[model samples]
Target: MATHAVRVSGLVRSFGDRNVLDGLDLAIAPGEFVAILGRSGSGKSTLLKAVAGLDYDVTGDGDIAVAGEIAVAFQDSRLLPWLRVVDNVELGVRPGRGTAALAEVGLEGRERAWPSELSGGEQQRVALARCLVREPRVLLADEPFGALDALTRIRMHDLLRELCAKHQPAVLLVTHDVDEAIELADRVVVLHEGRIGLDVPAHDADRTHLLRALGIGVAA
Candidate 1:
């Protein structure tokens, strides 16, 4: 059996009168790639944030053990205007460890360029690089490619898969696009009504069944 990287049981979170997450349970193995799909306001992002330790208000009797550090990449690039592309990517690194980090993201030569000078895709690449530089044990991504065009998004997906294969981090991605989840994740988990609606492996048959269960039509 694989060792669990993150475990959640009976997790609950409430905002005033509304319950965002109620009795949620999830278990993730090390180096697993899991994608979370949900409608708007289903607390998908909330769950990720809580697991990432960004939300302390959550109440749950769960065990989350990350052997390494955790890093997150938000929808926005979140780059500093004053810093160059490489510098932004290096922000997660120590003072002298920037070069190698930038190199890992394939931004070796563009380090000196400013964020504004790069395209949206390049900026997001820098953001991804920043997260990678941390060498995190778990990578939490919240719609990281939401802002890119179709071609760019596909390219980014490939890059992300390559990077994860190389680095071997447990990845949890929250995305609305079902195809994106199918293309990128080894498993797809659907969050509905503050609980896991479906959890299945990404094999051809299973993926088709899961998508149909989610009311998503498979490509004919």
Candidate 2:
């Protein structure tokens, strides 16, 4: 059996004239959280999609291997507007499991709430619940809290950390925010020009270093 929960070897992805991910390689251990950061159009999202198996149709030479189950959460909640909170979480899940998932995300009493009635943060919670209900062994998150207010984002971060600890799923979080990456990930990776430019433990990374890795000027 493979030792890593997720692995990408010799990965290459391109869009017409631009090679978004060129000969990229990444490995994620079980229950480890790795945050991705890069400048705009640096293939951050593209890399996540490739790992999540959404790039199956795209022509690529690399190989991806995953262990157990996979679940994804995007910046947009993507909940069906017509479905109630419980119904959305219950998608493809057994009856009554949605309530338990909601409770896990701190939305216990809001099972009957409509998607329209939820605030942005609450909606994201439901999205998280949807992913958690699957009992995934790998969780792919793409800027999952990017739309929330600062306080709400902090709260969601705490909740997410707790859930990941309990679930112990290897996590790949794609984000542009440096602080967010440092706050959540065991390791921080900066994708530059289609490859991993920097990979370091989060505890050893700082804002200025990360900014420089992304080719941004920092005032000294």
Candidate 3:
């Protein structure tokens, strides 16, 4: 049997009377890349937070297990303004890992630059590098490329694929773009009504089917 990098079983999270995640279950094998798609209030980020163990206060009869370290890259770069590029990546990690991680993400010489000096994409690269420096066993990414322009977003997708291939960490990418999910994920999952509505391989996927699952309909 293949080893799982992350496992969540029977998860239930609620905000007052509303249940964001209800008895959700998922597992990610080592080196697998999975993307999640859902509508605005379908509990996508809430699920990711649960898997990442960021939301401590939850009512659930479930367990989330990660074999090793976990890291998250958010929509915003979230780099400290005062820190230099490399320093941002190095902030809480070991000495040399940051340098190697920066190289891995294709930001080799921009280490000395400040957050304000770099473009949006560059800052994201630094954020990605920061996540990579820890050598996480599972990476939880919440719309890491959603803020960039079209061209830059595409570039970041390619870079992300390359980095994942090299590092081989199980990845869960949460994004609203269906095309982006299809392009990057080994498997794509759609969350509907706070549950796993569809889980399928990315290749030759039915986009309309996924859209419908998310309660979106085609218009004439």
Candidate 4:
């Protein structure tokens, strides 16, 4: 059996009277890339938060097991303005590790620049480097590339794939882009009404069926 990096069984989370995640269950094997596809309010970010151990306010009736350290990259870069780029990436980590991680994310030589000196994409790369410096066993990404332009997003996709292949972390990428999910993940999971609506291999799964599951239909 494959070693699992993340496991959640019978998980539940609520806000007010609405259940954001209701009895959700998931398991991710070590080094597996899982992309979660869903519309707004489908609980994708909530689920990632739960897995990252950032949502302590969540009330659940299940267990979550993660093999090692966790890191999260969100839609916003969230870089500290006053810190230099290297300082941002190395926050709590060794400077050498931050340098290497920045290089891994294709941000080499820009370490001394301030956050304001970089473009949106470059800032995001620094964010990626920061998260990666920890050498996390599981990476929780909540639409990390969503704010970038199309070209930058494509480049980021490639960089992410290369980094994941090299680092071999169990990655859970939460996004609304169908094509992006299929392009990046080994398996694509669709969430609907706060539950697993469909889970299928990204390479050979039927796009039409997946689109239908996501409530997207062909234009007449």
Candidate No. with top lDDT: 2
Q: For every model shown, what is its TM-score relative to the native structure?
A: 0.89, 0.97, 0.95, 0.95
- What's the lDDT of the predicted structure labeled candidate 4? 0.89
Query: What TM-score does candidate 3 get on C-alpha atoms?
Result: 0.95
Candidate models: Cα lDDT each: 0.83, 0.93, 0.89, 0.89
The segments of candidate 1 whose C-alpha lies over 4 angstroms from its true place after superposition are: 56-64, 204-208, 215-220
lDDT of 3 by residue, 55-158 (tens): 87766657888889899999999999998888899988777667778888888888788899999999899998999888888999999999999999999999
lDDT of 1 by residue, 75-156 (tens): 9999999998777876756765566766766677887899999899888888888888787888999999999999999889
- lDDT, candidate 2, 5-55, per-residue tens: 999999999887678999999999998999999999888999889988897
Worst ten-residue run, lDDT, model 3? Answer: 56-65
Clashes of 1: 0
* Candidate 4: regions farther than 4 A off: none
